[model samples]
Target: MDRIRPWLILVGVFLLQFFLSELLAIRYYRPDFVVIFILYFGLFFGSYYGVIAGFIIGIFIDMTPLASYFGLSPMTYSITGYLAGHLQDKYIRWSPFAFHAAWLCIISFHFLVFTYVRYQLLFEVDIVQYLLRWFLTMTYTLIFLLILQFFFPIKRIQGA
Candidate 1:
Protein backbone atom coordinates (compact mmCIF):
# COMPACT_ATOMS: atom_id res chain seq x y z
CA MET A 1 0.00 0.00 0.00
CA ASP A 2 2.80 2.39 0.76
CA ARG A 3 4.29 1.74 -2.65
CA ILE A 4 1.13 2.91 -4.41
CA ARG A 5 0.61 6.34 -2.79
CA PRO A 6 1.87 8.18 -5.84
CA TRP A 7 -0.53 6.34 -8.13
CA LEU A 8 -3.40 7.00 -5.75
CA ILE A 9 -2.58 10.68 -5.62
CA LEU A 10 -2.44 10.73 -9.42
CA VAL A 11 -5.90 9.27 -9.69
CA GLY A 12 -7.36 11.63 -7.10
CA VAL A 13 -5.77 14.61 -8.79
CA PHE A 14 -7.10 13.48 -12.17
CA LEU A 15 -10.64 13.13 -10.91
CA LEU A 16 -10.44 16.56 -9.30
CA GLN A 17 -9.00 18.04 -12.51
CA PHE A 18 -11.93 16.77 -14.55
CA PHE A 19 -14.81 17.40 -12.18
CA LEU A 20 -13.76 20.34 -9.99
CA SER A 21 -12.10 22.77 -12.39
CA GLU A 22 -15.29 24.30 -13.71
CA LEU A 23 -16.61 24.82 -10.24
CA LEU A 24 -13.37 26.08 -8.76
CA ALA A 25 -12.00 28.00 -11.69
CA ILE A 26 -12.01 31.75 -11.30
CA ARG A 27 -12.45 33.10 -14.80
CA TYR A 28 -9.22 32.45 -16.76
CA TYR A 29 -7.06 31.82 -13.73
CA ARG A 30 -7.77 28.24 -12.85
CA PRO A 31 -5.21 26.44 -10.68
CA ASP A 32 -3.39 23.55 -12.29
CA PHE A 33 -4.11 20.43 -10.29
CA VAL A 34 -1.61 18.58 -12.43
CA VAL A 35 1.07 20.95 -11.19
CA ILE A 36 0.07 20.31 -7.59
CA PHE A 37 0.43 16.55 -7.79
CA ILE A 38 3.44 16.74 -10.05
CA LEU A 39 5.19 18.95 -7.54
CA TYR A 40 4.17 16.77 -4.62
CA PHE A 41 5.37 13.47 -6.05
CA GLY A 42 8.39 15.00 -7.73
CA LEU A 43 9.69 16.64 -4.58
CA PHE A 44 8.69 13.91 -2.16
CA PHE A 45 9.05 10.70 -4.11
CA GLY A 46 12.03 11.57 -6.36
CA SER A 47 12.41 12.09 -10.10
CA TYR A 48 11.55 8.60 -11.29
CA TYR A 49 8.07 8.57 -9.82
CA GLY A 50 7.60 12.21 -10.64
CA VAL A 51 8.22 11.65 -14.35
CA ILE A 52 6.00 8.61 -14.43
CA ALA A 53 3.14 10.41 -12.69
CA GLY A 54 3.43 13.41 -14.96
CA PHE A 55 3.42 11.27 -18.09
CA ILE A 56 0.39 9.29 -17.04
CA ILE A 57 -1.46 12.37 -15.80
CA GLY A 58 -0.70 14.17 -19.03
CA ILE A 59 -2.11 11.31 -21.06
CA PHE A 60 -5.29 11.30 -19.02
CA ILE A 61 -5.63 15.08 -19.40
CA ASP A 62 -5.18 14.85 -23.16
CA MET A 63 -8.09 12.45 -23.36
CA THR A 64 -10.45 15.20 -22.31
CA PRO A 65 -12.02 17.47 -24.93
CA LEU A 66 -10.72 20.49 -23.02
CA ALA A 67 -7.15 19.79 -23.97
CA SER A 68 -5.98 22.22 -26.66
CA TYR A 69 -3.13 20.08 -27.92
CA PHE A 70 -2.82 16.47 -26.91
CA GLY A 71 0.94 16.30 -27.01
CA LEU A 72 1.74 19.56 -25.26
CA SER A 73 0.82 18.54 -21.71
CA PRO A 74 2.66 15.21 -21.77
CA MET A 75 5.93 16.83 -22.79
CA THR A 76 5.64 19.81 -20.49
CA TYR A 77 4.47 17.87 -17.44
CA SER A 78 7.06 15.12 -17.77
CA ILE A 79 9.82 17.71 -17.81
CA THR A 80 8.32 19.60 -14.87
CA GLY A 81 8.15 16.41 -12.88
CA TYR A 82 11.78 15.60 -13.55
CA LEU A 83 13.06 19.05 -12.67
CA ALA A 84 11.06 19.24 -9.46
CA GLY A 85 12.12 15.78 -8.45
CA HIS A 86 15.77 16.66 -8.91
CA LEU A 87 15.83 18.99 -5.90
CA GLN A 88 18.00 18.03 -2.94
CA ASP A 89 16.17 15.55 -0.80
CA LYS A 90 17.82 16.88 2.30
CA TYR A 91 16.57 20.41 1.69
CA ILE A 92 13.02 19.14 1.37
CA ARG A 93 13.28 17.12 4.54
CA TRP A 94 14.56 20.07 6.53
CA SER A 95 12.54 23.09 5.45
CA PRO A 96 8.93 23.78 4.58
CA PHE A 97 9.90 27.20 3.22
CA ALA A 98 12.23 25.60 0.73
CA PHE A 99 9.47 23.30 -0.40
CA HIS A 100 7.14 26.25 -0.94
CA ALA A 101 9.67 28.21 -2.96
CA ALA A 102 10.53 25.21 -5.09
CA TRP A 103 6.88 24.51 -5.68
CA LEU A 104 6.36 28.06 -6.93
CA CYS A 105 9.31 27.81 -9.27
CA ILE A 106 8.19 24.53 -10.78
CA ILE A 107 4.64 25.70 -11.32
CA SER A 108 5.77 29.03 -12.74
CA PHE A 109 8.14 27.37 -15.14
CA HIS A 110 5.39 25.08 -16.32
CA PHE A 111 3.03 28.00 -17.06
CA LEU A 112 5.76 29.80 -18.94
CA VAL A 113 6.31 26.77 -21.11
CA PHE A 114 2.61 26.08 -21.50
CA THR A 115 1.87 29.67 -22.52
CA TYR A 116 4.81 29.90 -24.87
CA VAL A 117 3.78 26.72 -26.61
CA ARG A 118 0.20 27.85 -26.94
CA TYR A 119 1.17 31.19 -28.44
CA GLN A 120 4.27 30.11 -30.39
CA LEU A 121 5.04 33.79 -30.64
CA LEU A 122 8.81 33.44 -30.66
CA PHE A 123 10.61 36.62 -31.79
CA GLU A 124 7.67 38.51 -33.20
CA VAL A 125 5.54 38.61 -30.08
CA ASP A 126 5.52 41.31 -27.43
CA ILE A 127 7.74 39.95 -24.70
CA VAL A 128 6.49 42.14 -21.81
CA GLN A 129 2.85 41.26 -22.27
CA TYR A 130 3.55 37.57 -22.51
CA LEU A 131 5.67 37.77 -19.39
CA LEU A 132 2.92 39.56 -17.49
CA ARG A 133 0.49 36.84 -18.43
CA TRP A 134 2.92 34.24 -17.27
CA PHE A 135 3.48 36.09 -14.02
CA LEU A 136 -0.23 36.30 -13.34
CA THR A 137 -0.74 32.63 -13.99
CA MET A 138 2.17 31.75 -11.78
CA THR A 139 0.70 33.89 -9.06
CA TYR A 140 -2.57 32.08 -9.46
CA THR A 141 -0.82 28.76 -9.15
CA LEU A 142 0.96 29.98 -6.03
CA ILE A 143 -2.27 30.90 -4.38
CA PHE A 144 -3.61 27.42 -4.88
CA LEU A 145 -0.36 25.93 -3.70
CA LEU A 146 -0.54 27.94 -0.50
CA ILE A 147 -4.03 26.68 0.16
CA LEU A 148 -3.06 23.09 -0.53
CA GLN A 149 0.14 23.32 1.43
CA PHE A 150 -1.75 23.81 4.67
CA PHE A 151 -3.47 20.47 4.28
CA PHE A 152 -0.52 18.53 2.96
CA PRO A 153 2.97 19.54 3.91
CA ILE A 154 5.82 17.20 3.08
CA LYS A 155 7.34 14.94 5.73
CA ARG A 156 10.53 12.94 5.39
CA ILE A 157 10.23 9.76 3.35
CA GLN A 158 10.55 6.69 5.53
CA GLY A 159 13.02 4.67 3.48
CA ALA A 160 14.24 7.12 0.90
Candidate 2:
Protein backbone atom coordinates (compact mmCIF):
# COMPACT_ATOMS: atom_id res chain seq x y z
CA MET A 1 0.00 0.00 0.00
CA ASP A 2 2.74 2.39 0.93
CA ARG A 3 4.63 1.71 -2.27
CA ILE A 4 1.52 2.23 -4.39
CA ARG A 5 0.67 5.65 -3.04
CA PRO A 6 2.98 7.63 -5.26
CA TRP A 7 2.08 5.78 -8.42
CA LEU A 8 -1.59 6.10 -7.64
CA ILE A 9 -1.18 9.82 -7.15
CA LEU A 10 0.57 10.06 -10.48
CA VAL A 11 -2.15 8.12 -12.23
CA GLY A 12 -4.83 10.23 -10.66
CA VAL A 13 -3.11 13.39 -11.79
CA PHE A 14 -2.84 12.10 -15.33
CA LEU A 15 -6.48 11.08 -15.46
CA LEU A 16 -7.63 14.41 -14.13
CA GLN A 17 -5.51 16.21 -16.68
CA PHE A 18 -6.86 14.13 -19.53
CA PHE A 19 -10.41 14.66 -18.39
CA LEU A 20 -9.89 18.39 -18.11
CA SER A 21 -8.28 18.56 -21.52
CA GLU A 22 -11.04 16.58 -23.16
CA LEU A 23 -14.03 18.05 -21.41
CA LEU A 24 -12.99 21.66 -21.39
CA ALA A 25 -11.78 21.56 -24.99
CA ILE A 26 -8.47 22.86 -23.77
CA ARG A 27 -6.61 20.77 -26.30
CA TYR A 28 -6.39 23.47 -28.95
CA TYR A 29 -3.60 25.12 -26.95
CA ARG A 30 -3.02 24.32 -23.33
CA PRO A 31 -0.29 23.56 -20.88
CA ASP A 32 1.19 20.10 -20.90
CA PHE A 33 -0.07 18.25 -17.82
CA VAL A 34 2.60 15.61 -18.10
CA VAL A 35 5.26 18.27 -17.94
CA ILE A 36 3.64 19.85 -14.93
CA PHE A 37 3.52 16.52 -13.14
CA ILE A 38 7.12 15.76 -13.99
CA LEU A 39 8.27 19.13 -12.72
CA TYR A 40 6.47 18.70 -9.45
CA PHE A 41 7.72 15.18 -9.00
CA GLY A 42 11.30 16.18 -9.73
CA LEU A 43 11.08 18.99 -7.26
CA PHE A 44 9.81 16.63 -4.60
CA PHE A 45 11.88 13.58 -5.36
CA GLY A 46 15.30 14.16 -6.92
CA SER A 47 17.18 14.27 -10.20
CA TYR A 48 17.17 10.53 -10.87
CA TYR A 49 13.48 10.06 -10.22
CA GLY A 50 12.68 13.28 -12.03
CA VAL A 51 14.51 12.15 -15.14
CA ILE A 52 12.81 8.78 -15.06
CA ALA A 53 9.36 10.23 -14.49
CA GLY A 54 9.94 12.77 -17.20
CA PHE A 55 10.87 10.09 -19.69
CA ILE A 56 7.83 8.02 -18.85
CA ILE A 57 5.45 10.94 -18.96
CA GLY A 58 7.04 12.22 -22.14
CA ILE A 59 6.34 8.94 -23.85
CA PHE A 60 2.76 9.03 -22.63
CA ILE A 61 2.31 12.58 -23.86
CA ASP A 62 3.70 11.64 -27.23
CA MET A 63 1.28 8.77 -27.43
CA THR A 64 -1.68 11.03 -26.79
CA PRO A 65 -3.77 12.56 -29.56
CA LEU A 66 -2.40 15.95 -28.58
CA ALA A 67 1.01 15.08 -29.94
CA SER A 68 1.76 14.96 -33.65
CA TYR A 69 5.17 13.30 -33.49
CA PHE A 70 6.47 10.38 -31.50
CA GLY A 71 9.76 11.73 -30.21
CA LEU A 72 9.19 15.45 -29.97
CA SER A 73 7.43 15.61 -26.60
CA PRO A 74 9.58 12.94 -25.03
CA MET A 75 12.73 14.70 -26.07
CA THR A 76 11.61 18.15 -25.02
CA TYR A 77 10.00 17.04 -21.78
CA SER A 78 12.94 14.85 -20.84
CA ILE A 79 15.22 17.86 -21.04
CA THR A 80 12.79 19.99 -19.09
CA GLY A 81 12.44 17.37 -16.36
CA TYR A 82 16.16 16.81 -16.07
CA LEU A 83 16.84 20.53 -15.90
CA ALA A 84 14.15 21.09 -13.29
CA GLY A 85 15.48 18.27 -11.17
CA HIS A 86 19.03 19.57 -11.34
CA LEU A 87 17.89 23.09 -10.58
CA GLN A 88 16.01 21.86 -7.54
CA ASP A 89 19.16 20.29 -6.21
CA LYS A 90 21.38 23.23 -7.02
CA TYR A 91 19.18 26.04 -5.77
CA ILE A 92 15.57 25.78 -4.68
CA ARG A 93 14.97 22.25 -3.55
CA TRP A 94 11.97 23.17 -1.43
CA SER A 95 11.09 26.61 -2.64
CA PRO A 96 7.64 27.43 -3.94
CA PHE A 97 9.30 29.88 -6.28
CA ALA A 98 11.09 26.97 -7.91
CA PHE A 99 7.80 25.24 -8.55
CA HIS A 100 6.32 28.35 -10.13
CA ALA A 101 9.40 29.09 -12.18
CA ALA A 102 9.83 25.53 -13.36
CA TRP A 103 6.18 25.25 -14.35
CA LEU A 104 6.34 28.51 -16.30
CA CYS A 105 9.59 27.61 -18.00
CA ILE A 106 8.43 24.15 -19.04
CA ILE A 107 5.10 25.52 -20.27
CA SER A 108 6.87 28.13 -22.33
CA PHE A 109 9.33 25.59 -23.64
CA HIS A 110 6.53 23.28 -24.73
CA PHE A 111 4.78 26.11 -26.56
CA LEU A 112 7.89 27.12 -28.45
CA VAL A 113 8.88 23.59 -29.34
CA PHE A 114 5.38 22.58 -30.38
CA THR A 115 5.03 25.68 -32.53
CA TYR A 116 8.39 25.18 -34.21
CA VAL A 117 7.83 21.51 -34.85
CA ARG A 118 4.30 21.97 -36.15
CA TYR A 119 5.32 24.77 -38.46
CA GLN A 120 8.47 23.05 -39.68
CA LEU A 121 7.19 19.54 -40.02
CA LEU A 122 3.41 19.55 -40.08
CA PHE A 123 2.02 22.79 -41.50
CA GLU A 124 2.62 26.49 -41.66
CA VAL A 125 0.77 28.99 -39.49
CA ASP A 126 0.89 32.71 -38.87
CA ILE A 127 3.43 33.92 -36.33
CA VAL A 128 0.93 36.25 -34.69
CA GLN A 129 -1.57 33.43 -34.21
CA TYR A 130 1.07 31.24 -32.71
CA LEU A 131 2.08 33.97 -30.31
CA LEU A 132 -1.53 34.54 -29.28
CA ARG A 133 -2.07 30.86 -28.69
CA TRP A 134 1.12 30.64 -26.70
CA PHE A 135 -0.03 33.46 -24.45
CA LEU A 136 -3.33 31.71 -23.76
CA THR A 137 -1.57 28.44 -23.04
CA MET A 138 0.77 30.09 -20.58
CA THR A 139 -2.09 31.80 -18.81
CA TYR A 140 -3.96 28.55 -18.34
CA THR A 141 -0.83 26.81 -17.11
CA LEU A 142 -0.22 29.53 -14.55
CA ILE A 143 -3.70 29.11 -13.17
CA PHE A 144 -3.35 25.35 -12.97
CA LEU A 145 0.00 25.61 -11.22
CA LEU A 146 -1.50 27.90 -8.60
CA ILE A 147 -4.14 25.29 -7.84
CA LEU A 148 -1.68 22.40 -7.81
CA GLN A 149 0.59 24.15 -5.33
CA PHE A 150 -2.14 24.16 -2.74
CA PHE A 151 -2.40 20.40 -2.85
CA PHE A 152 1.25 19.50 -3.38
CA PRO A 153 2.74 22.09 -1.02
CA ILE A 154 6.45 22.37 -1.59
CA LYS A 155 8.46 21.51 1.49
CA ARG A 156 12.04 22.44 2.23
CA ILE A 157 14.58 19.80 3.04
CA GLN A 158 16.17 20.32 6.43
CA GLY A 159 19.86 21.29 6.62
CA ALA A 160 20.06 21.30 2.88
Candidate 3:
Protein backbone atom coordinates (compact mmCIF):
# COMPACT_ATOMS: atom_id res chain seq x y z
CA MET A 1 0.00 0.00 0.00
CA ASP A 2 2.82 2.35 0.77
CA ARG A 3 4.47 1.76 -2.60
CA ILE A 4 1.22 2.20 -4.47
CA ARG A 5 0.29 5.41 -2.66
CA PRO A 6 2.66 7.63 -4.59
CA TRP A 7 1.49 6.40 -7.97
CA LEU A 8 -2.07 7.05 -6.94
CA ILE A 9 -1.12 10.55 -5.92
CA LEU A 10 0.47 11.10 -9.33
CA VAL A 11 -2.72 10.06 -11.06
CA GLY A 12 -4.74 12.35 -8.82
CA VAL A 13 -2.42 15.21 -9.64
CA PHE A 14 -2.85 14.54 -13.36
CA LEU A 15 -6.60 14.55 -12.96
CA LEU A 16 -6.42 17.81 -11.00
CA GLN A 17 -4.25 19.31 -13.74
CA PHE A 18 -7.00 18.64 -16.25
CA PHE A 19 -10.06 19.50 -14.20
CA LEU A 20 -8.83 22.45 -12.15
CA SER A 21 -7.07 24.13 -15.04
CA GLU A 22 -10.27 24.20 -17.04
CA LEU A 23 -11.86 26.37 -14.38
CA LEU A 24 -8.77 28.43 -13.67
CA ALA A 25 -7.60 29.13 -17.20
CA ILE A 26 -7.25 32.77 -18.13
CA ARG A 27 -7.87 33.11 -21.85
CA TYR A 28 -5.54 30.36 -23.16
CA TYR A 29 -3.15 30.07 -20.25
CA ARG A 30 -3.36 27.28 -17.68
CA PRO A 31 -0.97 26.13 -14.98
CA ASP A 32 1.14 23.00 -15.55
CA PHE A 33 0.28 21.44 -12.22
CA VAL A 34 1.46 17.97 -13.13
CA VAL A 35 5.05 19.17 -13.33
CA ILE A 36 4.85 19.96 -9.61
CA PHE A 37 4.17 16.32 -8.91
CA ILE A 38 6.97 15.31 -11.23
CA LEU A 39 9.28 17.64 -9.37
CA TYR A 40 8.14 16.20 -6.05
CA PHE A 41 8.78 12.67 -7.23
CA GLY A 42 12.21 13.61 -8.48
CA LEU A 43 13.07 15.29 -5.19
CA PHE A 44 11.86 12.37 -3.09
CA PHE A 45 13.04 9.55 -5.29
CA GLY A 46 16.11 9.57 -7.59
CA SER A 47 16.98 10.43 -11.16
CA TYR A 48 16.02 7.03 -12.49
CA TYR A 49 12.54 7.13 -10.98
CA GLY A 50 12.13 10.78 -11.85
CA VAL A 51 12.93 10.24 -15.51
CA ILE A 52 10.65 7.25 -15.77
CA ALA A 53 7.73 9.01 -14.05
CA GLY A 54 8.18 12.11 -16.18
CA PHE A 55 8.27 10.04 -19.36
CA ILE A 56 5.14 8.16 -18.39
CA ILE A 57 3.28 11.31 -17.41
CA GLY A 58 4.36 13.05 -20.58
CA ILE A 59 3.29 10.11 -22.69
CA PHE A 60 -0.11 10.16 -21.07
CA ILE A 61 -0.37 13.90 -21.59
CA ASP A 62 0.66 13.56 -25.23
CA MET A 63 -2.04 10.99 -25.80
CA THR A 64 -4.65 13.51 -24.78
CA PRO A 65 -6.66 15.35 -27.44
CA LEU A 66 -5.24 18.73 -26.45
CA ALA A 67 -1.62 17.89 -27.21
CA SER A 68 -0.34 19.79 -30.23
CA TYR A 69 2.79 17.69 -30.65
CA PHE A 70 3.05 14.00 -29.89
CA GLY A 71 6.40 13.88 -28.14
CA LEU A 72 6.89 17.39 -26.86
CA SER A 73 5.60 16.80 -23.32
CA PRO A 74 7.70 13.68 -22.88
CA MET A 75 10.82 15.53 -23.92
CA THR A 76 10.31 18.58 -21.71
CA TYR A 77 8.95 16.80 -18.64
CA SER A 78 11.68 14.15 -18.74
CA ILE A 79 14.33 16.84 -18.81
CA THR A 80 12.67 18.68 -15.92
CA GLY A 81 12.43 15.47 -13.93
CA TYR A 82 16.06 14.60 -14.64
CA LEU A 83 17.27 17.97 -13.43
CA ALA A 84 14.98 17.90 -10.41
CA GLY A 85 16.27 14.50 -9.33
CA HIS A 86 19.84 15.79 -9.20
CA LEU A 87 18.79 18.38 -6.61
CA GLN A 88 17.36 15.82 -4.26
CA ASP A 89 18.65 15.95 -0.68
CA LYS A 90 20.73 18.96 -1.62
CA TYR A 91 18.50 21.49 0.06
CA ILE A 92 20.53 21.34 3.25
CA ARG A 93 23.82 21.79 1.46
CA TRP A 94 22.67 24.74 -0.65
CA SER A 95 21.70 28.17 0.53
CA PRO A 96 18.01 29.00 0.54
CA PHE A 97 18.29 31.41 -2.37
CA ALA A 98 20.28 28.96 -4.48
CA PHE A 99 17.89 26.10 -3.88
CA HIS A 100 14.89 28.20 -4.87
CA ALA A 101 16.77 29.53 -7.88
CA ALA A 102 17.60 26.04 -9.07
CA TRP A 103 13.98 24.85 -9.06
CA LEU A 104 12.86 28.12 -10.67
CA CYS A 105 15.36 27.60 -13.44
CA ILE A 106 14.21 24.05 -13.94
CA ILE A 107 10.55 25.06 -14.22
CA SER A 108 11.37 28.00 -16.46
CA PHE A 109 13.34 25.82 -18.82
CA HIS A 110 10.56 23.28 -19.03
CA PHE A 111 7.97 25.91 -19.98
CA LEU A 112 10.33 27.67 -22.36
CA VAL A 113 11.05 24.53 -24.31
CA PHE A 114 7.44 23.46 -24.26
CA THR A 115 5.99 26.77 -25.44
CA TYR A 116 8.70 27.39 -28.03
CA VAL A 117 8.24 24.05 -29.72
CA ARG A 118 4.47 23.91 -29.50
CA TYR A 119 3.99 27.41 -30.86
CA GLN A 120 7.14 27.81 -32.89
CA LEU A 121 5.49 28.52 -36.23
CA LEU A 122 2.64 30.54 -34.81
CA PHE A 123 4.94 33.02 -33.09
CA GLU A 124 7.77 32.86 -35.61
CA VAL A 125 7.31 36.39 -36.83
CA ASP A 126 6.52 37.86 -33.41
CA ILE A 127 9.34 37.01 -31.06
CA VAL A 128 7.98 39.41 -28.45
CA GLN A 129 4.64 37.63 -28.46
CA TYR A 130 6.35 34.29 -27.94
CA LEU A 131 8.29 35.59 -24.97
CA LEU A 132 5.20 37.14 -23.46
CA ARG A 133 3.18 33.98 -23.77
CA TRP A 134 5.94 31.88 -22.32
CA PHE A 135 6.37 34.26 -19.43
CA LEU A 136 2.67 34.31 -18.66
CA THR A 137 2.40 30.56 -18.69
CA MET A 138 5.45 30.12 -16.52
CA THR A 139 4.28 32.78 -14.12
CA TYR A 140 0.87 31.21 -13.84
CA THR A 141 2.34 27.83 -13.05
CA LEU A 142 4.74 29.34 -10.57
CA ILE A 143 1.90 31.05 -8.77
CA PHE A 144 0.30 27.70 -8.12
CA LEU A 145 3.60 26.32 -6.98
CA LEU A 146 3.92 29.18 -4.56
CA ILE A 147 0.45 28.58 -3.21
CA LEU A 148 1.18 24.92 -2.68
CA GLN A 149 4.39 25.74 -0.90
CA PHE A 150 2.55 28.10 1.40
CA PHE A 151 0.34 25.23 2.47
CA PHE A 152 2.63 22.18 2.42
CA PRO A 153 6.12 23.68 2.29
CA ILE A 154 9.07 21.96 0.62
CA LYS A 155 11.20 22.56 3.71
CA ARG A 156 9.19 19.91 5.53
CA ILE A 157 9.71 17.52 2.66
CA GLN A 158 13.45 18.10 2.71
CA GLY A 159 13.64 17.60 6.48
CA ALA A 160 11.77 14.33 6.10
Using lDDT, give the best candidate's number.
Answer: 3
**Pairs of colliding residues, candidate 2:** none
User: Which of 2 and 3 is the better model by TM-score?
Assistant: 3
Q: How do the residues 116-152 of candidate 3 rate in per-residue lDDT, one tens digit apiece?
A: 9988975788999899899999999989999999887
Those runs of model 3 whose alpha carbons end farther than 4 Å from true positions after fitting are: none
Q: Ranking by TM-score, best first?
A: 3, 1, 2
**Between 1 and 3, whose lDDT is larger?**
3
lDDT of 2 by residue, 43-114 (tens): 667667777776776677667786678888767666766766665654445465755565567668766776
- lDDT order of candidates, top first: 3, 1, 2
Q: Estimate each model's TM-score.
A: 0.83, 0.75, 0.95
Model 2 stretches with alpha carbons more than 4 Å out: 1-3, 89-103, 121-125, 155-160
Q: What's model 3's overall lDDT?
A: 0.87
**Clashes (candidate 3):** 0
Candidate with the greatest TM-score versus the true structure: 3
